[model samples]
Target: MPREGLEVENLHLWRGEHHVLRGVGFALPRGGCLHVTGPNGAGKTSLLRAACGLLYPESGRLLWDGRDVHEDLPTFHSVLMYIGHEAPLKADLSARENLRYWIGTRRRIGRDTLGAALQRVGATAWSERPARTLSAGQRRRVALAALSLLLVPLWLLDEPTTNLDAEGQQLVGTLIEEHLARGGLVLAATHHELPLPRSRVQRLELTHE
Candidate 1:
């Protein structure tokens, strides 16, 4: 059997009396993709946030690579990337500049590859345009381009397909497949279907009573 990717046990969260997740437990297998789905306020994003260490759980445990995440946040974080609902980009920077900044400072994937990543996301046309001047979809492409700079093993994405056209969606799908092929794990909260073949996907539905 393959190594366990991530694990959550009895995960419970609260926002001042509003219970988000309730006793959630699951294991993300290496090279697998888990799709988390739910109505708004069902805590899909909350769960992803907890797994990524952005939010602490009220009660429970989270482990990455079979080790407690909080025990070694540095190592755990090095192998994980989290993309939230809002696109994390700087308005003053051009698309290429943004990619180079992330690659050079955060990911260390080499600034020279920034151009290739932008081209792969079809944002090469405006790679030199400031992020604020680009359309929403165009901006999203630039943000997604940063993913190409990551060489980690786990990805946690929330609504990653938003603002993407059909072809752009297909592009991201292909990247997901490539990541899985390289033994990476994906835990994504998406409201849309992915355009990939032979994927191992687990759907999680959340409900509040």
Candidate 2:
């Protein structure tokens, strides 16, 4: 059997003169969840970005399934799905249109599948509204719908519950639980604690460096 998971080792990063991350490290296997916790300016987002190869760390190794991610980034990206703080929808595009355009490029998605995803996230009411016209919570729901449609094995989420209400936050927890049940991996940076079991959740707390 092979080592199946994502590993970040002795990671370090710098933004100008400030040392944002210092020796941050962790390893998460299939069905594993890593909660990256830290206050503002502690580099939680930077760690997630670096793990997904969006920002190269000054010094670190990111391994996916025992192989260096840098060896074949495209292959790694194919299995990874990243959802940042901001919903990546085009402002002028309708919510459905934005999802359609985004998902069409990555994989084949059917109308029924898309509708179900939107409905799952409680975004069906505004599914046809322009993204710019949607509220923050609505936009976040749209993003969650996109996440459902992507169906990748690994999720790198930054503040997934941003702008969501109590019910919306619970919905996110359900989505994560379902994803994890399917042997998916999740690395989330959030101020709000996820509603997951302690046995399945791993924590890495960073402080000002």
Candidate 3:
């Protein structure tokens, strides 16, 4: 497997007429996790989106394996998994159904693997429940379960623990740890403290321009 490494150089973005990210740069190697922190109106979210090719930078560039991500978007996206604040689930679909839908888009997964994923995220009990009927935390778990179903090397997460309680928060930490242990890279924007060990984690703080 290729070692996933991400580099952002002098990134600058504008949201409307206001500048969001200003000369932002960072590098994350395989098995590393970067925690992005800042107050509201700061450019943390913008930075994550730019890094994942969701938003284009006005200047500078994002590189995966030292090549511009925009140069080959499909290859970059194939190894990247991004989960923002909203749970990207269909209201009418059951949690299992949603997972199956997303998994199908990437690769085939067996019933056992799906079950294990749900179990790992503590969403097994409500796996058959419609997403709309689940609580915020439950829905978030359903989204997190998708992580277990796939092995993407880079994860760009925005407020991953948004609606979770203590246990759910712990689950997120465990998942990050497991991913890092397997040499996956993570860049997360969060207001809350994540439970990752400092050795494998780095911090990046953003300020509003």
Candidate 4:
């Protein structure tokens, strides 16, 4: 598979009456990572949402491989994965159950594959525990396990290191590094520094006006 590219052009966004993003633009090539940094209310989350078609920008375009993302919703979504601040998992479901539910049988991932993903995030020991019974950090780890099962080219992550301990944080960094090595792209909004190589990393700092 060829590495994908993402381009954001003149992006302008608003939150009700407030203008959050103004003319933000950047390009991420294959095997690249972009870290979005800023203080509170700087539209870092909004930019990620817009890039993945979650929120519509007032103006500008999001392009994937030189074509507008909106032009082909299915193709765009199939190639991208978005992980927001919330760990989108079912509290009543066990860690393994949650993965099975999210990935579904259509993808043909076996139990061993799911277990391996949990192990990668150090959640294998707690795979049978309900998400609600897990600590905040453990829940985050379960959510991150989806990254291993989904073989998408683009990743949009918001606050990926939230509630993680030192080892957990290091695990996330290592996973991201491996993803980049395989010709994947990542755009993350985070306050802490990640383990991305300097040569493959780009920075976008949002400012509130």
Top candidate, metric lDDT? 2
lDDT of 1: 0.83
Q: Estimate each model's TM-score.
A: 0.94, 0.97, 0.96, 0.95
Ranking by lDDT: 2, 3, 4, 1
Cα lDDT of model 4 by residue, 1-209, tens digit: 43249999999998899899999999999888999999988998999999999898999989898889998987898898898898878999998999898877336788889888989899878899888899989988987898878988999999999999999888888889989899999999987887656766789888776
Q: Can you write out model 1's per-residue Cα lDDT over 1-209, one digit (the tens) per residue? A: 42478988899999788988999888888888888877888898999989988889989999887788989887888889888887777899987887787657765565457778888899878999888898888877876787867878999988878888999888888888899989999898876765666346887777885
Candidate 3, residues 89-198, lDDT tens digits: the string is 99999999999998789989989999999998888788998888999889889878987678999999999999899989888899999899998999999878887767
Off by over 4 Å in 3: 1-4
Candidate 2: C-alpha lDDT: 0.91
Residues 1-209 of candidate 2 have per-residue lDDT tens digits of 55899988899998899888899989999999999998998899999999999888899899999999999999999999999999899989999999999988999989999999888898888898888899999999988889989989999999999899999998888888899999999999997798777787899999995
User: What is residue 206's positional error in candidate 3, in angstroms?
Assistant: 0.4
lDDT of 2 at 37: 91
Off by over 4 Å in 2: none
TM-score of 1: 0.94
Top candidate, metric TM-score: 2
